[model samples]
Every structure is written in structure tokens, then in C-alpha cells.
Target: MLPNKSDSRRRLNATGLSTGDYNKVNTDTTETDGFVNEQWVAPNVEEPIPWKTIAIILVLFVGGTICICCATLDWLADVNQDRSDRIGALTIIGALTIIPGGYYLYILLCILMHRTGYTMDDIRRLG
Candidate 1:
């Protein structure tokens, strides 16, 4: 036997939803109690320290600074016997070096913050 359409209309009226809106809302079978399930993408675990990468970066920064300084000294020692020209060139090199130096400082600061008990919750809040 078939159910009556009037009975369905009566039930929908009791819930205060029109038939068209009711059909639209009930089409998605996966959603439960009006809350849709979502996939969690971001990891909630503790961050691991990259010791080897950090060591390599620090070593590269120090070694490159020493080598560049020595090369600059040697290059200027051979040419431009004047003080003003060497000072100008040094200023340019110093400006260029600031970018990498700033990055190195940032990496060190991140490591220090982690050492000082910075957690993922704190990071999420700040971000």
C-alpha cells in the first residue's frame, strides 16, 4: 500500500518546513544533525627539531661570512689604494649581507623560542 501525500504534508507542517525547503535540506545524506563532517588536514602533533638542517645553515652562514670578508679584503688590497673607494664598496657589501644575516637571525630566534617552551598552540594563536 502507498502512503498518503496529505499525511506527509501534515508531518512537514508540524515541523514548520515547506516541502521544497525540506527536500533541499534532506538531499545530503552524509550530514548528520545539521553538522557536516570535515577532514582534518593540519597536523596537531608537536613539531620536531631539524638539528642537521639548522647545523648546516649555521655552518654555511659563518663559513661564508669569513670567506667573503677575506676575499673582499684581498680584492681591495690589490686595487684602489684610496680609503674612500674601499669604504663605499664595503658599504655595498654590508647592505647585501644584511638580508642573509637577518634570515639567520630569524632561524636562530625560532630555535630559541622553541627552547623557551613555545608550543604549537601559541603559534596557532599568534598566526
Candidate 2:
């Protein structure tokens, strides 16, 4: 007489256990549980401000404004004194100051206006 399916399964299981003395332990079960509890994930961060660039811009702005003011003062002093040599010298100096100062001021304003909220895309677009 042939044994039933359950009887055959029992015989196979008994033989497998006897042949291999190693135990079947679920090691991954505890490791998976610990990983779920920890819940590790990366975070988002903001980009740093370009402070050195800003400092350089401020210096250029201040220096240009000072040059313009100095030239204006010299011209005014010459006009008061009523001397042709002094007037010619001061006029030339003032003209030189006005041109470069205006250009520098415009550049500084552009920089200030475009200061914040910049990315690689924005810089590419600026070109």
C-alpha cells in the first residue's frame, strides 16, 4: 500500500533535517525590522551666498562714488578761485571721473539688482 501525501511530506522533512544539522534561522527578519525603525533619508539644503563677490562689488561702488565726489569738489574749488589753469585741470579731471564713475555705478546697480535667487540656469541665461 502507498503512503498518503502528508505521510510522504513528513518522511521527506525528517530526512532533510537528519541529513543537514544546520538550523533555518530568519536573520533578515530582525535586520529588516531595525531598518524600518531607523527610517534614514537625505535632506534638502540651500546654496551658500557669494559674500566675497558682494564685498568686491561694494568696494568698486564706494571707490567710484568717492572719485566723482572728489572731482566735483576740485571743479567747484577751481570755479571759486577763477584761474584758467586750475579750471582746465579740474574740468579734465571731472570729465574723466564722470565717465568712469557713471559706468561703474551702472555696473554696480546691475549687480545689486541681480544679486539674489541665482542658479546655474540663471547664470546661463544672463549671457
Candidate 3:
């Protein structure tokens, strides 16, 4: 024969055991209070300017400019086939040097002018 549910519940209660519903709903609505012992703050650190990188970029820009100018002048002064080939080579080399140097120099200028989205970190080191 099966035992009655009430008899089992009474026995459990007598033994100090709770057989009540475990999934009770919480109806109380109250805001929780939280506190911090100490507030955290970030340290202030300044980044130094990279002068050597700037100098290298400046040199490349100037050297490339001179190379292109000299090549142009030499090409205009003479129509010799050999000189034309040399001038073309010089012009290509000058363009290659000027591209990166000019780009970084522009970035440096933008940083100096305090432009938004431009920073010292934008300039890469050659070393």
C-alpha cells in the first residue's frame, strides 16, 4: 500500500525538514545600495616628440625634391637618348622617396596643428 502525502509531510515536518515549494516568486521591489571604498584615477603621462624620425623624413623630402628638380633640368637641357634614360630613372627614384616622406610629413604637420584624428603615433620609426 502507498503512504498518504499528508502523513509523509507531517513526518518530514516533525524531523525539522521543509517540503515547501522551492520556486517562490519575489514580489518585493527595492533599490539596492552599493559603495566603493576608494575611487580609481588614471595617471598623467606625456609622450616625447620623435625628433630623429622627423629629421629623416625631412631629409627624404628635400633630397627627393632636389633629385626631381635636377632630373627635370637635365632632361630639358639635353635630348640625348642616354641622358633621357638616366633622367627617367632619377625621376622614378625621386617619386618613390617622396611618396612615403611626404605622407608622414603631412601627418606630422597635422599633428602640430592639433587636427582631430592625427597623432604622433601615426609617424613610424625608420630604425
Best-fitting candidate, measured by TM-score? Answer: 3
Backbone collision tally, model 1: 0
Question: How high is each candidate's TM-score?
Answer: 0.38, 0.33, 0.64
Judged by TM-score relative to the true structure, which candidate is superior, 1 or 2? 1
Clashes of each: 0, 0, 0
Model 2 gets an lDDT of 0.48
State the local distance difference test value for candidate 1: 0.50
List the candidates ranked by lDDT, beginning with the highest. 3, 1, 2
Clashes of 2: 0
Worst 10 residues of 3 by lDDT: 3-12
Q: Which ten residues in a row have the lowest lDDT in candidate 2?
A: 3-12
**Candidate 3: regions farther than 4 A off:** 1-43
**What's the CA error at residue 25 for candidate 1, in Å?**
2.7
TM-score of 2: 0.33
> Between 1 and 3, whose lDDT is larger?
3
- Look at candidate 1 and give me any clashing residue pairs: none
RMSD of 2: 19.4
